[model samples]
Target: MNVRQDIHSAGVPVLCQSCEARHRGLCGALEPDQLVELSKTASRHGVSPGAELMGDAEVVERYSNVLSGVVKLTKSLSDGRQQIVGLQFAPDFLGRPFKSESAINAEAATEVSLCSFPRTVIERMMRVSPGFEHRLLKQALNDLDEARDWMVALGRKTASERVASFLLMIARNIEPASDPAARSASFDLPLTRADIADFLGLTIETVSRQLTRLRTDDVIRIESNRHVTVDSLSRLQQRCGD
Candidate 1:
């Protein structure tokens, strides 16, 4: 069955990053019984491409971590102009940690796999588990750094620089560090041109133009419409003004 139906069914014991949990999720600091108890109140959900997990202004009751695929955090103007503020990738956490609702909405950019537990339950556990609390704090700090980085990109970076930086960020996510291969570094790109445009504060056409420029300059090459290969790290970092 698909992810949607699978949540309602009992899953077998999964051996992953943690025998108790994987990917720095709540299971990392909890015992098996603790995980099982939380899972009891928890739910698993799959979202189809473009399906919203939480819309803007809606209070969220659960927290999630991506098991597979991607999701995007976005916001829109009352007039309907939208900006993508964050990209969620596999092994990454999703949803607001300390808040109930956000001004932004989160939606699946592709078919998504998620493990969701009730916020109340998780928060309760945090009060008793210092390790769990520290993990959450670290996650928040990481997100803060990413947000600051975006301010630099949106406020100062040019269109070409924005696209180049975007590619570099995706590559970093897929492989913990940058490693070149076969004259071009390649990795799956989870966002579309429009999403990149939103994140970079540019229109779709501008995003396309920058991508073309990067390709022509041999900074990056698009192996597929959705997959990118970077040819030079120095040039890519130079584009970021780093």
Candidate 2:
């Protein structure tokens, strides 16, 4: 049998066969044999919401693939105040490769699932697998681009636009594979109102006011203060002022 057939028949790890990361994440760059090797040391686990996955200035011993749910990245100031910097969804790599220490705190914004491997194992693979290294570089560049975009949003976007943009971001990332033609989505808000405000650089009251405005305009529907349904993602996108 050929390599592809061999991989399908037995080379691929059973646990990884149906994993989203295997198809969409860094593991996609690895060969079937490499996957089997990696799986020997890899572990799968779940984290509760608000739990810290990694803390700032901590030693970097492992990296993870976000299997499901949202991870919020934050940085703290000297006075212990924190700022929400970014969010990672399923299939996103979850650590800074080659860094000796973590520069940010990674916490579960929602109940999260992860597939993690030791840092030494991953770094060794990167040295030997050009494709794996290339994938890591690509993700890093994509993150930088997103950070720049968010900088613009925070620096210049109006409060209404920022809130809309935040909602649009959550909708797209939460259901990344949803049909574009449908233009609709429903999900529980992963972050609380205070957290959302912090991320968007707005006050909690301002966040609530904008959400109320969106609901009144029929752009979105809110139930139980956390459940949100977007009737038309296109309309929501229009509100983003992009």
Candidate 3:
């Protein structure tokens, strides 16, 4: 990742223009000149896997776009139990708008690169740009919908079904839209087995056993603990009861 320490680049405009999220996320509503202005206040950073982007209960004064990789949103109970509530992928916006602090832990699930700006800047942008605010609202609604769906999965799905459903979700999200013929999808699992257990509301042993069962059944191919290759998304989805 190109670290934007200076917050100014010789080709900032070009860089913003070529950004993957340029037309798909918050920046999509900005005009070319507006992008040029916004780039001046923007900075980019690469976050190592497992690092905290935002801690639970920490004051959040900045906003960011996930330029690449995944981030996990986690929450911990007073009794010390923690759960993985949601996952954020590339091009997703980070930070809660109109709020002063984070309610969940935001951790890098993979090597992540982000483009960030001050929260004040974003709030200001929303005030003047209806299109930008509208986009943010849309994103918020989508995130809420996903969260509710996952809640249902965690509360009602069977163990094997949960594992299969998890895999299907990851496969769908990680697959590139440009690759229509990618009959099989391969990627490293962003979360550890323990983390997966928390996310699926299962025990570590159960998660491992289910994963092995999936591999044995030819629903997936596990090259290593983290490396996973799904032979057929359709089969995985079937296992997920999709």
Worst 10 residues of 2 by lDDT: 1-10
Least accurate 10 contiguous residues by lDDT in model 3: 1-10
Among these predicted structures, which one has the highest TM-score?
A: 2
lDDT of 3 by residue, 1-242 (tens): 23344223543476586687786788988766567667777889999998999988899989999988889998989998777889988788999999998998999999999999999888988988898889899999999998888878877889999999988777766635224455678888888998899889899999999999999999999886888988788888888754
Candidates' C-alpha lDDT: 0.71, 0.91, 0.84
The lDDT, on a scale of 0 to 1, for candidate 1 is 0.71
TM-score for each candidate, following the candidate numbering: 0.80, 0.94, 0.90
Off by more than 4 A, model 3: 1-12, 175-182
- Stretch of 10 with least lDDT, candidate 1: 12-21
Clashing pairs in 1: none
Please report the candidate that would top lDDT against the real structure.
2
- Ranked candidates, highest lDDT first: 2, 3, 1
| Model 1 error, position 95 (Å) | 2.0
lDDT of 3: 0.84
Candidate 2 collision pairs: none
